[model samples]
Target: VRTYKLDTVLLILKCTQESKGCSWYIRAAKIAGSDFFSVTRYRSKHTCSRAVQSSSNCRRRGNPRLVAAVLHEDYPGQFDTPVPKTIVDVVHRRAGVTVSYSTALRGKQLHVSDVRGTPEEGYRMLFSYLYMLEQENPGTKTNVQLDADNRFEYLFVALGASIEGFQ
Candidate 1:
């Protein structure tokens, strides 16, 4: 048997498990669509097909709340951390580029403490977190540009690109 990490185990359980109200994949499909497979493409080239194939059986299994609960155990942040405005200003000043949304939300201040981690470390962590968020809420456009320093930054949250500090 393939040994899975806690997150993977929870993901499989979430995407494959079912319940009376709805199954894991059914709900996820509503959010992620049949291309739920595409989300897992990085894990394995065949993950998409396998995930879709297993989705059917998962619907019969009943109740994915447990899986959600399990996944939550691993993912404590609810995407609640606010993307700070200072970071956004720094990004704009450093990048010498205007990220779309940042221009609009310029006046609205966000607390840096909420997303206060090392710039590079936070960059990677936030990317993974937002990637998962993209899987859950694939609603926004993601655009990326490099700063004058050549550091990467992202546009919208749904777009899945990293923002050096741009909100």
Candidate 2:
């Protein structure tokens, strides 16, 4: 359930064993002037004796989008993309959450695509960028190498100002 006051928003999440008076619940409140949230009250121990604490439902699951966002925060402007195993390890270590390899791969791919545009869109924008560069800077040399099927393979550019400065 969600309850909010004039300056604070309160959120409460309960376990499925609530019918038996389980104390497993989390209560968090939003800080007044910031995007941060603080957990004011929480109970990790469940009172009910149904052996549900070890179940999958009781574990916290991070979705693909949440994983992507975490990756962005953890590794800003990162080089050397992390593999699925590394992604899982990082999430487990940092967030205490276990994610599947498939999910981790999807999240990493999503974050990478968000940072670097998709291949089709990138190729489309490359022409526009090269044209603008050549037009704005006279003597700017640009070359695009393509393969047999007319696909992008390589790109080379020489800025006019740089060439002039070199000479």
Highest lDDT against the true fold, candidate: 2
How do the predictions measure up, each by TM-score?
Answer: 0.23, 0.52
| lDDT (Cα, 0-100) at 62 in candidate 2 | 66
lDDT (10s digit) by residue, model 2, range 1-167: 11222244777777666766877778888988986679898888878785555444446666677678778888775634689889888888878878989999898988887777788898889989999999999989999999999988899999999999999
lDDT, candidates in the order shown: 0.37, 0.79
lDDT of model 2, residue 25: 78
Runs of candidate 2 exceeding 4 Å displacement:
1-12, 21-59, 120-124, 135-138, 141-158, 161-167
Model 1 ranges with Cα > 4 A deviation? 1-115, 147-149, 158-167
Tell me the TM-score of model 2.
0.52
TM-score of 1: 0.23
Count clashing pairs, candidate 1: 9
